[model samples]
Target chain A: MALLTVQDLTMHYRTKLGGVHAVDGVSFAMAEGEAIGLVGESGCGKTSVAMALLRLLPDNAQILGGEILFEGRDLVKLSEHEMRKVRWRSISMVFQAAMNSLNPVYRVGQQIIEAIQQHLSVSEREARSRVAEHYNLVGLDPKLMDRYPHEYSGGMKQRAVIAMALACSPKLIIADEPTTALDVIVQDRILRRINEVRAEFNMAMMYISHDIAVIAEVAERIGVMYAGWIVEMADTVSVFKHPAHPYTIALMSAFPSIKGDKRVLAQLPGEPPNLLAPPSGCRFHPRCPHATAECVDEAPRLEEIDKGHFVSCWHPQRRSQ
Target chain B: MLRFVGGRLVQIAITFFLFLTVVFFLFQAMPGDYTKQFIMNPRIPPAAREALKVRLGLTDSVWGQYVNYVRNVFTGNLGLSFEHYPREVWDVIKERLPRTAILFLVASVMAFVWGFPLGRYIAWKRGQTLDYTITVAGVLFYTIFTPLLALMLLFVFANQLGWFRTGGFLTPRLWLTPPSSPQSIFIWLAATLAGLGTWAVLARFATRRIGHPRPRRLAQRGLVVVGVGLAGLGWWASGLGPFAWDIVWHMFLPVLAVTLIAFGGDMLLMRDSMLEVIREDYITTAKAKGLPDKVVRDRHAARTALLPLVTSFTLSIGFVVSGGIVTETMFSWKGMGLTYLNALLIQDYPMAMGCLIFTGILVLVAHLVADLLYAVLDPRIVY
Candidate 1:
């Protein structure tokens, strides 16, 4: 059994523009102690997948159809009261903007203590000691635990949020585009810290970001998302080395380094199709160069082209292997 | 910090000069006769009244009279009072000013002392039943008309219950026209400067200093606080009753009423200001530091959020003065507001104009004080 399985999960958002098919029939499963990357365009439903998995989707959003089985428990059926117990305990997430995520009027220690004490039946002093211990683990000075959030640098704030997520020692952590908002230097440091946490605790994580280069560094398995569907999923090394699906080939060709010596940077023409009313046959057909009559009429289902490697394109080998 | 204050002072002087010029011509727009109140109702011979007008420069062009009035004001003579039996405009103001100043200032302080902490509690527990209860109760208490609230408190605690004095500055016998001796002078001075309301509220809402915060650098902080308090008290003492105790005794009600009113406003403003500040991202950072919510709120948010409240203090001067319109009348206290109301009815033109000019100056000064305070609270905020 997988550590986490999200099968046929469909999440639609009712927006002012109309019903947005934010996460349409997305399916994936994670093994214990595995790290996966969900790479996509800005609105290609990566965040929707993360938010839906946590049941933290906003008021107007609805899980239209789905089954999210985590350790044999169906998370979708749990009430908000029951789910609150699961959040920050069974599953935790860290967002891109760490500073704004925390409450300003509270001390960093108190917020962590709140998470720890809220989840466990521990006394205040014990919660505080654990808070001090976590601060030390993040390489922050435990003595400055009484300071305000503003006193810390941007990197420190992100680390604090990471520590907060780890308060319950959650099995699976979801980090959504965590480095997208940080400076280049700070981004490297945050990624290093996240990797260390996983190594130390053996926690499975879902890393979401637009930068394929950053995702390549940490993600063991990579999933390229187009519109609301996963166009391709494979071992990171294999996907980086051998591009298969046309969208994946286009994505690799566009990033000069991805195709090794042969691939010079090549830009894809036009934009990702609007998920609200995407193309009938294939979401990426408009952007796919080798799109055929069959591609224009039939959407490709994800098929295992090789062992533990997946592709969802009619002409999977469009480019020279 | 010092530079911001200096700039504000210069701004205030420019504003004061412009307003002073405007007030000089206010009488020119009015249709009242400054010389008529002193004249009898019986028909004076037309010649005598005309002669009286001429002697008083009533026949002069409005500009000429205005120029002369401004000149006299500069020379320390604010002309004479038509409302007071026989006194100058300057004297009448000097006599009534202290009571108003003492009452207003003390009330403002008392209100902040009560409201700030209460507002914080309500904010910290926002959306809870206790928070809602306090918030609703505060709004309701503040909504009750000042005079009526005073009367109701008076009725329950004094008339019906005889727990406290109903209204008035002192024992009715101690009302002062002028000091008869040295002891009466002390009474006048004390009563005119001290807050009767603060005395009462302090007793009811006596709070020990928060954090059991032992004054660190005790000698230095203690002296500064005492010195500042004394300076403020001295300024207030300069304008009140003739004798010390009588002035202090009479100041009781006006001061108390002001304090009560301020209690609600400052606290409510604080509650709002704190709620807004704590919602910012920095609060979460503060929380992640492992500081308790209490320390985070008080140290991080409270001091920065206090800037708006300091700016708000400028507005309280107007409320205290306007509020004194009722406080003075209820207590039978003779202050600028009560005296102005009387002058309006009797059509005492000189007294009325004097009151208007006086209030306009006080309002301007209060506004200047508020602007100066901003730099002190948050030096980074430049406006």
Candidate 2:
């Protein structure tokens, strides 16, 4: 059985303009120790899906429908108190580290220790030792643990945040743009460290990032999200080698491959659809090159196009031809 | 840090001297002197008036008098008040300082004590009915005229309900036996507070290495409560109860009026600051840690939100030395503001300048203290 299965999870943000369809019908499953990368353009509901899974959404966010089956229990039906027990203990998150993610006034070690003690009935000494161990895991000096967030460089702060997320030894860790704000060298090192830590713990992870290349490096499976829907999902190699969905194809073509023959990077036309009043048919059809009359009038549900491969498009293989 | 403090002190001294000089010159440039009140009187002869001018130093060159004024100020002799003839400016200020300090400082503390939590809650519940209701209500109270609110509170609480004294700092009947002066009462209160504060600090330091946080915090709070209780009981048992009660009873309405008017601004400020802080990424990180909602709001959000509130609070307290003119006047409390106003109207240069200089020094010191507090509260700030 999968460690976590989310079926038809729908969430909307109630704003003055209207209900923003942020995460509409997002569905995926992760087995224990599996790593899935959800890559999409900014504001394509990747972060929303992560927030929905953790139930850390703001006041305006409303979960319209979903069943998050985790460990054979429906998390959507769990009370807030019960859900809190699931968080950080069973499932923790590594937020965007460079965006003041740690409290400015608190010691970095104290924050990690807090996460450790919140889940486990450990003394401060035990929590501190655990924090030190995690600090070493993330390649940070244990001495810097007592320092405030501002005292650390951007890369060090990210490492500290990663240590905090790993302190609890959570079953599943959702990392959202963990290295987006760091330099390329630091980003690569941090990504490698995250993969090493994940491998050591044999933990499940759902990586959220706009940089598909970064996700490609660490994620075993990749889910391509567009306009609040997962347009395609498959093994990383298969998705990269033969992207079946037109949107996925366009996304793949947008990135410059270092090894590929010289070619102009393809620019996908048009902007992301407005979620408040999203298009009636396929949310991506307005910008889909293979869009037809049927694509304009009817939305296609995600269907298994091959073994272990899913695509939500009227003409999934048309882009390959 | 010492260097920073020392530099700030130097800056304060220079600013204070400049403030004194400007006040002295402004009073000098006024149309007349304190002797103007005796202009229409025929009781004094010309020769006597000349002696009085000499005694008041009105006949000296303006530059020479300014030098003398600065020297006397540096020597801590603010000169005699013309309105209160033989009374020195410092003596008059000392006599009234306690009354104003007690009323305004108590009201300011009361405002923040309640305002901060209310603002935090309303911000946490933003967009709800409670939030809107409180925002509207706070804005209403904040925008109301100070004197008008004081009058309304005075009439209802003192006249209609007859629950407390109508006005003034103390009832004359209760003060007939002269239990103690207001200055002594203020001094005693300050000393007791200092003692309690020191005890609380030491208790916190004693428990700094405690393994468990929740119990340590509880014990610290318990110690403070016990300390305050003991102090209060000791004061009452020492036979200061009647004097204290009399003063409290008479000043209750004024303090309430001031608090009611003042807390709204603090509430609104805290609400805005909290609203901005709750949107920060750390707040979401705190939530993801599986901490309770209250912990996220208070520990993670409210603590950061308190930065701006601290700045507002310290500066407001600094202004306490200036005293509230409308509140004091409406309630018939003769504090610093009333004295300063009377001196200015009658051109009592020394007393008016004394008040202005004192206020300036307090504000300057408060700013320096605020900068230090910011560095302490927010570790990102270096000296």
Candidate 3:
């Protein structure tokens, strides 16, 4: 059985303008020790889907419909009291922008210790030891925990945040653009450390990022999202080799390759559709090169086009071709 | 840290010197000198008036008087008061300082105690009816003139209800002399011990019940009940004489007025700060860590929000030295405000200069203390 499965998860944000369908009919499953990368543009609801899995959406957001099945129980049905027990224990998250993710007033160690003690009935001393251990696991000096977030470098802060997420030995970890704010060198190091920790713990992970290259480095399978819908999902190698969805193909072509023939970077023709009043048909129809009359009128559902590959498109790219 | 403090001290010294110079020069430029009161008296002949001006050094050159003033101030001689001749200006201030300190300390403590929780509650329930009601009330209290509030309190609690005395630090009827007899001394000592004992017992009880669930709250309420009962018993036992109770009773209106004004500002400040802090990413991080709502709000949000409040708290302490002038006047409270006003009215240059200089020093010291506290509160600040 999968460690976590989110089926038909529909989330909307209530704003003055209208309800924004941030994550519409989003479905995915993660088996034990599996790592799935969720790649999308800025407002494609990538972060929203991650937040929905943990039931951590803000006050303005409403889960219009969904089933977040974790450990054989529908998390959507769990009370806030029960859900809190699952958070940071069975499931933890590494938030984006480590600078603001950690409380400025508190020492880094105290924050990690707080997370440990909140879910576990452990003494302060025990929690401190656990925090030190997690710090070591994340390639950080145990003494760095004594320092405040501002005192540390950006890379160190992100490492500390990752250490905090690993403190409870959670079964599943959601990393939401964990290294987006760091320099290129620090980003590579942090991503490598994350991969190492994941391998060591054998924990399931859902890595969310806008950079396909970063996702390619860590995720075994990638789910491409576009305007609140996952346009495609397949094994990393297969998806890279034969991207079925036109949106995925355009996104792939956008990434400049070093070794390939010198070609101009392909740019998607239009901006992401407004989620408040998303298009009725395939959400990507306006920008899809293979858009047809049927695609303009009917929204396509995710269907297996090949073994272990799902493409939500009326006209999918063929592996034989 | 040492260098920071040293720098601040030098700045303070310069400020003090400038303050003294401005005050001295401003008073010198006034229409009349301190000897005007004597000159206006018809009983004093022209020859007597001239001698008085010479004696008071009013006939000296401005430059000579400035040198003398600076010299006297440096030597710890604040000069004699013009109104209360022969009495030192420092002596008059020393006599009144304790009353002002007590009034301000009581009001400030009460304001913080009442304001912080109310502010936190309002922030937690931001869009609720309770938040709106308290916010409106806070604005009303903050905007109302201090003298008006004082008079309203005086009328209702003192004049109309007769619950407290109208004015003065003590009741005129029962001005008991200090205990000279052994029996009276014994009674005073016993009352003092009783008050101390009651407080100790309450503290011990509270400390013991710190972690207990509902009983801790119950114990706190019980402690207040017991304390009030003991205080009432002590008042009756003292034959209802003019004791500490009389001072507290007379202090009621003035303290209430000051507290109302202070409470409003403090509450609104805290509320606004907490509202901003709650939106910070760290607060969301705390919640995502699966901590309870109370922990997230108090530990993560409120702790950070308290930075601005800490700054305001120190600034308010400086204002305490100035005292609530209008409120003091309305209630006829003999504090620094009244002393300063009296000095100004009589053109007592020495006394007025002393008050202004003291206030300036206080404000400068408060800022230095606030900077030091900022470093302590937020570890990121090195100096």
Candidate 4:
């Protein structure tokens, strides 16, 4: 059985206009100790899905229909009290914007220790030891933990956040754009450290990011999301080499590769559909090159065309072409 | 930190000197002499009036008078009041300072104690009916005129209910007599020292347990003020020989009026600050850590939200020494507010200058303390 499975998970945000289908019918499963990247544009609901898995969505958001199963228990059905037990113990998150993700007034170590003491009945001294160990795991000096977030450089703060996420040895860690605010060199180093920590702990990870290149480097399996739906999910190598969904193909072609033939980067024609009043079919159909009348009338479902590979599209791209 | 404080002290000295110079010249520029108020009869000889002007140094040139004034101020003379003949300005201020200090101190404490938690709750419950109701109420209280509020409070509590005295710092029945015997004076001194010692111990513990240093430091300062104020009151009580509780009863209406007026702004400030802080990424991180809702709100959100309120609290303390002018006046409370008002009414320049100068120093010291507090509260803030 998979370590975590999100089935038919739908979430909506109540806004002035109407209910926004931010995470609509998103389904995926992660095996034990596996890493899956949820890649999408800014508004594609990848972050929403991460937040939903943790049940940390803002007050305006509602989990319309979903089942988040972790270790054979349905998390969506659990009370807030019960869910809190799962969070930080079973699942923890490294939030986006590392610069602001730690309280400014508190020392970084204090924040990590707070998380440790909250879930575990550890003495302050024991929690401090655990914080030091996690800090070392994330390649941050334990002494630097005494400093406030503003005192640390962007890369150091990101490492501190990763340390906080890893403090509890959670079964699953959701890293939501963890390195987005850092420089290229810092991002590379932080990502490497995250991979090392994950390997050591054997924890499942859901890496959410808009940058497919970063995801390609860290995620073993990749799920391509467009407008609140995962259009493709497969091993990273297969997804990159032979993108089955049209949206995935367009997204891949849009990036300028170092080794590929010199050509203008392919741009997807339109924006992600407005989830408040989404297009009445496959969300990517309007922007798809080969969208047809049937594509507009019927939404596609994720179907396994090959072992361990899924594609959601009315017209899956041919590998030969 | 020492260097920063030293620099601030030097700046305060310069500013105070300039203030003294300006105040002297400004009053000198006023039409008609202030000493004229001292003369009751026009039938008095011109020679007698001239001698009075010379004796008071009113006959000297502006430059000579300025020098004499600066020298006298440095020597702590503070000059004598023209309206209150033979009474020194400093003596008058000393007599009135404690009453004003206690009244405003209590009001400020009430404001902070009531405002902070209430504001934080409203912010945490933002967008709910409770938030809206409290916010509206806060706005109403904050915008109400000070004298009007004071009068309304006096009318309700003192007039309608008749539960407390309408005004005054003390009952007329209790005559305050200084402890003359050496043994009695020694006992009062020992009691005051004991109170100070107890406060010091509690303040040390409070600093350690309070977590955040800014509020802890504030609490420490507040503890000192309360301790000293209470000790002084105790000393007075001992001297006065079993006074009635009527003094406290009299203070109720004015303190309530002052607190009502001041607390609204503080609550609104805290609410707005907490609203912004709740949106910070750290709060979301705290929630994701499986911390309880209360922990997230208070520890993660409210701690950061308290930065602005720290500065505001310091500024409010600066105002404390001056007392609530309109509130004191409306309730007939004989605090520094009424003292300043009386000096201004009779154009008693010496007394006015002394009060204004003291207020200025307090304000300057408050800012310095605030700057120091910012560094303590947020490690990121450097002097």
lDDT of 3 by residue, B213-307 (tens): 47777777777677767766866776643465566677778888888998998899999999999988888788889998888888899889889
Instruction: Say which candidate scores most in DockQ.
Output: 2
> In lDDT terms, how accurate is model 1?
0.74
Candidate with more favorable, higher TM-score: 2 or 4 = 2
User: Each model's C-alpha lDDT?
Assistant: 0.74, 0.88, 0.85, 0.85
* Model 1 lDDT per residue over A1-321, tens place: 699999889988988888898888888899978999998889999988988877877657999888999989889998766776777787887876786776544577777787787678899899888888888887788776677666778888888888888887888888888777779888888788788888789889999988888888889999999899998999998787776888887776666554346645788999988877889898888888889999999989988898888998888883454
Q: TM-score winner between 1 and 4, please give it.
A: 4
**lDDT score for candidate 2 against the true structure:** 0.88
Residue-wise C-alpha lDDT for candidate 1, range B97-168, written one tens digit per residue: 766776677677777878888888788777799988888777776676888877776677667866566555
Model 3: runs farther than 4 Å from truth?
A319-321, B37-41, B45-47, B176-210, B213-241
Point out the worst 10-residue segment of candidate 2 chain A by lDDT.
Answer: A312-321
**A76-171 per-residue lDDT for model 3 (tens digits):** 899999988888999999997677999999999999999998899999999999988988888899999888898898888999999999999999
DockQ of each: 0.15, 0.81, 0.75, 0.80
Question: If both were scored by TM-score, which would come out higher, candidate 1 or candidate 2?
Answer: 2
For candidate 4, lDDT tens digit of each residue in B261-312?
A: 7789889999999999999888888888999999899888988899999999
Residue-by-residue lDDT tens digits, candidate 4, A201-320: 899998999999999999999999889998899999989888889988888888888894688888888787888999988888888889999989999999998788899998998773
Query: What is the overall TM-score of model 4 with all chains considered together?
Result: 0.91
TM-score, chain A, candidate 4: 0.98
- Candidate 1: deviation at residue B253, Å? 21
Better of 2 and 4 by lDDT: 2
User: Residue B153 of candidate 3: its Cα lDDT?
Assistant: 89
Better of 2 and 3 by TM-score: 2
